[model samples]
Target: MSKSGDDQVRYEPAAPKKEQGGAQKPASQKSRPLLEYSPVYLLVTIMLTLFTAEWLIMIILNMAPGIPQEWATLINALALTVVIFPVVYFFHYRPKVRDLAELKRVSLVLTESERRIRSVMEATNDSIIQINEKGLIVFWNRAAEALFGYTAKEIMNKKFLTLVTSPRYYVFFEKWFRNELDLVKKNHGDSMGQGQFEVFIKRKNEKVIPVEVSLSSVWLEDSLHTICMVRDITIRKKAFVALKESEKRFREALEKVCMVTAQVEANGKIMFCNDYFLRVTGWEKKDVLGRNLFALFIADKFHAALKKRLYESIAMRVEIKQMEQEIITRSGDCRLVMFNTTNLLDHKGRVIGVTIIGEDITERKKSEEIKKESNERLRKANEELQKAQTQLVRSEKLASLGHLAAGVAHEIRNPLNIISTSIQLLSMEERLSPETVKTSRIVMEQVKRASKITENLREFAREKKPEIIKMDLHDFLERTIALVEYEMSLENITVVRNFNSGPIYLLGDEDQLAQVFLNVIGNARDSMNEKQEEFSYDELQKRGWVGQLVIETIVNEHMAGVRFRDTGVGVTRETKEKIYDPFYTTKREGKGTGLGLAIAYGIIENHGGRIEIESDVGEGAEFSVFLPLATERNA
Candidate 1:
């Protein structure tokens, strides 16, 4: 780059940018004021001499005047006083006045220069500094203040050598700027902007700073002065550090995303590997970085393809697409990973390295296989039945997911309701009360959030309006039972039931009631799954239960009820109390959303009926649902 002065962004490992062949721009004039030395003293000397000459003339006048004796004596006294006063004033006061004037000029210039330098430095993203020949900081700009945390005033006139550790470099600077070097330069005539050097500087806080030092000989009043411009390259150094850290973090995160990332340099060096890669390949970082790309485990298995894709990426400077390959793990197990290669380019767009991203798609591939088998089994199962089983199973899966959405919404609603109510109540409090007012408002805001969640649950479940129909309750339970029968049988669950035959009728939504049956039955099935492996016959008998599940139905004059009893592991006392809440479930993580009973309760309430549940932790649970019979309907 073209430069009258070099910006200090030094580095030892990397060469500085070569000077570009371009038109040279004229160097701008330096803005700092010239230091005053002889001129100030000369001006003071001239003024004092003129004052003395006037005093002498006055003294001579007093000695030679023609006058009366008394008048002449008074004139001599006045003349002596005049001469003495002038002499005292010049000696004492006038010099002080000249010093004050010079000080004012110096201060004004310093203030103006400080302002300009501060403005430029703060405006720049980089830091600027000036170190004198003795390596003392004479000037520091505002950006330096921000970067190093030291103000100009804090370190001014202090030996700059103290800031830099190992002041041996000061020797190099001294020799470079000494009069011995200048004579050589003067003999050569007009040597400007030469012998520019780069070195790393340490900040006041001991941060390693990179800088470029430019030595320029400029004449100010016929004396040679060297002004070294220091630019701090902390940011560039930080970038280099960040890039390395990012590579490390990338490897760590990839372990979770389950990918193998490798960097291949120009000389075919395999620059990185993570835990999974090592576990799979029996190789460590020692076995990687700077090693030949094709020498690692399973290299021959993938070496040719990798080299081909690598060359393609490097040549094209674009990403190479997914390449499937297998590598033997350190455990002697082979895992499949789909690899992608990309070229890492420099500022000039030359490919300097290649980054390969490999994802272990083995699990995904296995999942696809399992899905195929499940699909075949499902197809066979469907063929053995009507559309009802297929529809019901799908609905149950969707319902399970919907339970999450609904529970979130239902829980949110209560809080949201609380918030809204609190906000309203707050306004009714005495006006302009900050604490009370703020709390109330915050409560309402939270209530609004809950309300939104409720709305979302409604949308997710497609549950907006209650649909009513008179339906046989037993028939509903029978269908839901059939839907889960295969799942229960797979777990070897025994179901017991006793039905008191009666002409029972209920006025309620058939599908919603069915939902209640499905939820209850599903919970019963889960409990059975839990106890299937852990319980013995003796333990089951102690719980007032014999097996996994029991279903019983009965009808009376007022209401028809179904008692769903499960011998599966039951709910805790606490769980029983909250069983009817919208989103409460205890089927373990990722299993239940705790919303089944809540929805069932809502449906029952809408039907002018109610639901109840009873549970014992080690024993089992029973859910009894009652629905009021329709007026005049047979019971």
Candidate 2:
């Protein structure tokens, strides 16, 4: 009725509470006896009885001697009117009217209270419900309807426990409700006659939601009632779980990081450090916390520079990156560290501290120092070695040239002596005979032979530059193969061509490459022919030996290659090593000059190519010539 500063009014929608007893029976059953007694009819019957008694009394008086019937009747009527009417009207009828008026007033007040309660319940965000002692739902508000997905009509008169309890929570509700009822009954009208708890309620859609509930008990019409104020806590629960998970992930990340990470105050006091920082610094977290970071860890030489950087980073808000410095550890050993530092800011963007992330680079620094020293040593050693190798190569070249000159002179002298003898023989005759004419022709042949040797020597001595051109290696190999086909066939040799269809271009002197191929192919054919002479065709077939030359064209990332292989007696290791040397021929006298391979080697070298030979004593030899792939510049 009165509002106070400290007191607040709260409205709860009244619903039937679950009780130990069963559901409330209908009002008709309780009102049946009262209806039978009908007060209006009872009053009428009493008046009739009084009137009948008066009439009888008047008759008796009239029948008696010396009595007046009219007088008796009048006297009885007066008595009835005066005593009975006043008594009935004042005591019964007036009281009934007054009681009815009081009942109407109370009903109006109850209705107004209920209407206010409903308005408050609907206005509040929380779902409110009141349950009565009979376990029947007497109230369901708009908030409750929205929360539970059931309208007030649908939920009204239903048992409270039926809406909230499932089989899973039946035992829990039973115990909880028993306890709550005990409290409500024991503290019937106490100020703190309430209990709060959390439970899950299933909505009409069968969706379960967690709710925080505050309960209050009140006496309504001499019966116990329980009010529940429920709030949905799903969002709060999710946020709490997320915060806990975020904390866990933060701790895990700090533990897993490999670098040293630390936070420091602007004054260089260490505020926090991760696991790696503690381990790397050889200090416990407690030992390092609140200590001056630079004084404890940084070497003295870097103190000034680091302090300057720290000041700049915090004051100017500049980040220092990849600063290489040395820090002394607890064991008094200096470690090289590469660290980056940035200012840590507060919500207002004011610098609060600094964060330092560093990696231990001591071992790397040592390795770099060692590598630098070793590189210096290796460079000096290499220079000296190169000089010595150069001198040795020059000496060997001179010696080889001297030997070649001697061989050339000896070879030429033989032909020259033969020509001289032939000339002398022809000069002795004025009219030369047939023998003399033959001697003259022999002289001419010897001179031609000497000239041919000179020409080969000249070619060997000259250095020819390659006129580089872009050409398909396969096509070149095919053309070279055609030139040697007839020769190989004459020796009963089979030339097997293995060439990829794709074009493999190389920058080279095509003429020089052709000459190289021709020389190699000629050697292959010669080798096979020499082998054929050693074994009969049928015998060679029986031995599974065939005069075969395999020419394979191959390409790789940097070079294109052509392989020349011959199925003949391979050269010995000793002869193979010297096969590319000048004047080293295995051919019979006058059949070869031994300059073909030497020229091939020089030509390939000038074209920036490599010629590699693979051979065994019994197996055939393979010569792979690799020329660099042509580039746009070379083309």
Candidate 3:
């Protein structure tokens, strides 16, 4: 072999380099050929040797006369093929084969390394999870199965937000990220460094555990992978919580607040309640912990409802007002309290617990209630004063009516006296003119009409005791109608009875009931005056000038009621309010004496019955009357 080992011209086996101390590369990789053993030299040497040998052999063969030229050519070809093929194939072609084997070895090493890594990941005891920057779980490992009561298959390919009772943190992240992008837009700088933050994770059971982690970005092929590493510190958290409780009383006292102290989980459960809580609930410490906050401090019927609302509020990351709520104190006192609830969130904006503050407002409520009752009594006294004033006005109007009636009566009576004496004298003469007799008779008729006016005024003034009897209300209505039927016919008013079919019972005097009916019907007729033309009334024919009047009776077991509604010209809202007062009317002075409705109102009130009137300017008027049934009245 050549000293440099390059002239050997064979593919050398891999041999470890002999070195001092430090490692060295194999000979196959580091060794190189000498200048004489170059690829070009090897090729030239073979060619030149073949050329020289062939010439010598050809010369020797020529001297053999017995050999044919074609046979000589064939023998030279065979010899050249045997020797030249072995040298060129071994030195030149075999190195290419070595290169192919080396490539396979490298590929095998890469595959083995990948397999070992995969095995370690699957075998790890602690949960090895992969999540995107959005906090969605990309992978779940066996360690996760042991820690959380979920299989890897259950969590794979799902967002980490699914296990959380409230997903507000996710929403916050999206908002924060958007804000970061906005910052990037404004400054045109990399926001990736500033945007990364740790987020708390909640388990499927609604236990929120703080985690320590960071974000990393990788370019895999042409895609980006954002990864995070998470660890559960629930035990550490509980220890920290216990320590806080040990210090809460001291802190609250130092803070100079009498507010009841409590520790609620992020999901709104009461984990620990202070001595104040036990005092309020009337229960020992055992009764407070492990109970939903809503149950301990609120009504049972709304527990399910409040739970849902609370969850939604947490999801939205909002605080709730502790409005007035009832709570059973430890002393069995159910007191009303006004409460305020605020969320306790972490640095990452994750809800850790709810903080509630409540104050008793019952005494304040009682004082306000007493003030309300006093005001109501004062209001009732004022209404009675108003009624008394109305009575005085009605009494004055009656005195005026009496004076008018006396004057009218005197004027008619003087003329009637003259006519009557004249008629008697004429009759004695036995030859009286027909006109004279007619004149006397006409004067008498006018006097009688004046007297009728006097009679109506007297009837209005009269106050009579009711005569009680079991009578059909319908018959009473009919009799009253008959009295006014002639007047109605003259006015063309149509009376409609949605009147109940009954031996409709009532306890009342016939005369008093008649008086009541007279005033009510008279008032209705007066209202129809404006609609006379519309109802086709012609005073000459005594035709249909009256509007429809509906009287409806409603009977219930405890009471018998009647509703009288009219389609006549309705009263205005202002007039309707004062319609039941004495001497209130829209009729002209000569046309009506306004005592009719006033008298009706008084009579119904004296009977312990109520009349309710509902009317608007154009919608017409309805009046309902209610009186207790006879049996109820006796009771």
TM-score of each: 0.31, 0.37, 0.52
lDDT of 1 by residue, 518-545 (tens): 8778878778777856766567668665
In terms of TM-score, how similar is model 2 to the real structure?
A: 0.37
- In terms of lDDT, the poorest run of 10 residues in model 2 is 25-34
Number of clashing residue pairs, candidate 3:
12
Which is the better candidate, 2 or 3, if ranked by TM-score? 3
CA displacement after TM-score superposition, residue 175 of candidate 1 (Å): 5.3
Alpha-carbon lDDT of model 3: 0.64
The candidates, ranked best first by lDDT, are 2, 1, 3
Global local distance difference test of model 2 = 0.76
* Count of residue pairs whose backbone atoms collide, per candidate: 12, 10, 12
Residue-wise C-alpha lDDT for candidate 3, range 253-370, written one tens digit per residue: 6235555556677666786666655665667778777877775676677677767766766778887786666676755567777767777677567887776666667677788899
lDDT of 2 by residue, 350-406 (tens): 998987888999899889999999999999999879956854674466357646755
Winning candidate number (lDDT): 2
lDDT of 3 at 576: 71
The per-residue C-alpha lDDT of model 3 at residue 323 equals: 67
The true-structure Cα RMSD of candidate 2 reads 21.5
Q: For candidate 1, give the lDDT.
A: 0.65
